[model samples]
Target: MTVQSIAGPRFSWRGPSNGWRQREGRGPTLALALFILVFSLIPVGRLIVAAFEGGFGAFWQVLDAPDVWRATRNTLVVAFGSGSLALLIGVVFALILSVTTLRARTALAFIMVMSLMIAPQISALAFKTLAGPASPLLKLVGLAPAPGTPNPMLGEFGIIVVMGLHHAPLVAITLASGLASIPRPLIEAARLDGASPWQVVNRIMLPLLRPFLLSAALLAFVAGTGNFGIPALLGLPVGYVTLPTLLFRKLASFGPATIGDAAAISVLIALIAGTGVIAASLLLARSASRLETDHRIEPFWELGRWRPAVEAGVWGVIALTVLLPLASLLATSLVPAYGVRLSPSSLTLAQYVEVLFRQDLTVRAFRNSMLLAGGAALSLAVITLVSAYVLDRAKPKVKAFAFALIELPYAVPGIVLAIACILLFIKPLPLIGVSIYATPWIILFAYHARFFAIALKPVMAAMATLDDAVQEAAVCDGARLGQRLRHIVLPLVFPAVFAGMLMVFLLAFNELTVSALLWSAGTETLGVALLSLEDSGLGAEAAAVAVTATLLVLVLMLAMQMLARRLPPNALPWQALAGPDRERRG
Candidate 1:
């Protein structure tokens, strides 16, 4: 029997089962369902009501404005442009690392993935310090622009480049896994038939990787279009606004009519993103059935004397894309003043000490960030495990709608979701009084919605691997549902849960856009605090906060890396389970 059949009945009741035990058993699940309904579904409903309550008149006015059109066009252009660029760069790196005989390929892969570990705002700040008008490199070349010079390279183009680089690691890793799925024998056969390298890639490799590439592209597009941080930091200074920034501008005015118009924009963004996510999921599902492991590493093509040059190129790209920007940020933090001559006398720890000691906001921001991150991490872990178990272990009987419901928020941007929360909870409800706006809970809920997919994916993937026989054996021994989860399931899936927790923690701590909208006085997170300082012409203080925040993130990331190392190699259980099925057929 298959694992699903052996796992026992989907629903069962205990003594005196007059449907009372069944109903009682469902109490926890029902409570969870209601919680999700009220938290997730209700907010969305409010957003919809707010959108149409204005009679669509205000929406039309906003949509018809020339500035709105400009913003919309700019948003699309930047998203598409950045997504395409990221895909191209990702594909190149993936190909080289996966197929070539380059030195330090493994290290290159790690560096690529590490870029995504840092928040986008942090990455943009690094780039701005490196490539801005006062950059040391510009000065060295005697090409330093005048003070207050408008550098186009550091405006819209720079925003796209930074965002593209920020997301490329995910694209590269996903595409590399797809490329790794292709059979070595097929490539060898084509080679034996005297196919050129270009021909082999164009006709064979490219065709096989189409599904993965398309999915990655769609994901990148959604992320790029919805992203607020990069645009807020890099583009705002140059008057290059996108949808999220435009919506923020409107809502900050706090006019009821204007807020309704912003809600309309938020709904529109969510709809567009949701449609893309659904399309990508459908496409991926079709391709998933054909996926098989073909892990045989083919013989590397000899570059002979050209190998050194190839290695040099790969290292150069990594340094340019990741290292240089970070170094610039670090260097700038020590300088006494912006645009000052780079001399030993100019370097001091005064800014750091001042920001750390004199600014009470910095300490409060750190405490708030910790509270949100810790709470979100713990909450998501429990929710993800319960949901994953229900979906993977219970299967068909659990309702397919559950999966759809969980996946719905993947396409919704943080900014739009924040608006939904505000629109929904700002009014007094029957049972739940008090508006959620200006409360820290709103930030927590936003993080949950934004990162629910990420936290669940790894857990679901791990759960898919375990043989159902193990669970059945435990059930046959009279282990209850809670016991089964605590003893049999939880121990096995804990690694994945831990990894997911680490990721959620990192993301929550560094989160900006949603917090920026939701944060009230005294609830400042590091991200918003840094942005506020920058906006208020406290560049030195902002740099100090930025440095502290980056170091904290790096420390957490290092801990996660260590945890990942300690975990079992086959923590990705779904792949392990799928491998045997494919091998049996072969």
Candidate 2:
């Protein structure tokens, strides 16, 4: 199982003849585990404890509230509706781009993935600006609602639509990974039997892709259920509240007095998300027996006459999902005021100039977001290096436990993690006597809890590809643990560590959900700041900020695209679509 790096030094491995306990020093490993426990396990444990602190009656009372039932129903509705929409969109694009001769698929996939990177609040804002009374884009086309019209994107329907489109790429990427593993010969045999494209998909491909499709659906459900940004911006204004927003509003108006009730609501969210993840795992395992180990695959479909139409349709989808909303955002930003139509006589860059320079709050937000995201990324890079090493070498059961603990916080909705942080940090520290509940530090703590898994998973993957024999060789050469890690292990896995850092940075930078609840006036993040401006009737300025932030993400994405080739396969999720292998297969 040795994997030699194509560019870097060769990595080789052999089985450890010894038990899980290695002769390498255990200090870093112990420290890493303790750090994970404090960040990952303790917060969740505290939230759960607080939920029942007032006895089981409190849990039942919270559950019995009419709002809880309403939120629960709304949560389920959005989860199912969005999950289905995302699946439908994701599977179609995945199959076409992966199997058929669709032109510009690489660019299309890139744009669709860009949708995922846009913070949910930003996405909601863009769409909100596209169709409401304030929509310049709609006004120019004579499609804008009247001046007194309520925003069309401010209710249950809007939440479903935005979330569905937002999560579509997640489904597409997951299904694409599975599609890549399908043996080409299977599809070829069916085609040779006089099967039409649809027939082949129905009788051969779909069956094999069942587990992946379900897995994607489950992931979308989990995402939608825990989502705060989309629901917060779209739902709150229309009085359509989901669990995450409900919890947030409850805490906001009632303050610390509602901690027990908030924790109870948080527990409900945890249960819903946890169930979906467990089901996905079981579904994947049940279907594992059907997947062959050999992964050689070739493109299996050709839409020769229909290629133009299919490609046009995909681009149309991209326009709707990515271009239109962004264009609307830009158009709105250039207006002299909110609800003003854009034209030769009316266009201006005043909003952008204001947010970028005149407004100290906006400027402070940019600094805070960068500082928090940058600090978390750097810290996780070091922590994950050691954490991944321990996970790679630990016994199977222990490894599973550690992995779950790492993933639990992330798996729950961001709102749940924020609540957990609130419950854990509301009071002063035993020795330090400082409260972080209203400060930037609390947001940082929540970021670490939610994103540690994002940083750890990639490094663990890179570690798995390394052969144990390399490490054993270092051990035999009288190199101690620290020396081996520095001279051999870190160098081999540094690429993954670097990739993880960039991913975590990008994600945390645009993050809104955790900070939405934890942020005080001075602690506002980019997301919180944008929402605040919008809420305060500064829609044009918010649009300006949204456009600015999106441009920054686009730049980071371009950097990632440039770096993809030198890194290992699958380093960037979009690499598969952009690679030469795709062209050859097509």
RMSD of each: 4.8, 3.4
Cα deviation of 160, candidate 1, in Å: 2.3
- Among residues 3 or more apart in sequence or in different chains, the pairs in candidate 2 whose N, CA or C atoms overlap within 3 Å are 12-467, 13-467, 13-468, 13-469, 14-469
Q: How well is each residue in 1-586 modelled by candidate 1, as lDDT tens digits?
A: 2433343354232212333234236645664576467556777778888887758786676577777788888888888888988889888877666565566554566567667777777788778877657765455456667778765545779888998998887677667556656777888889899987778778988898899889878878888888888888898887888988898778766644576778878877787677767776776666655765545434345556888898888889889989887776766677776555455777778778877777888778878998998898898898888777655634353535666676565567888888887776566656867666678877888788777767777788788777767776676677787887889889998888888887788888888878878888888887888788777866666777777777776676566556553354423222221121222110
Give the alpha-carbon lDDT of every model.
0.72, 0.84
TM-score of 2: 0.94
- Tell me the TM-score of each prediction against the true structure: 0.88, 0.94
lDDT of 1: 0.72
Clashes per prediction?
1, 5
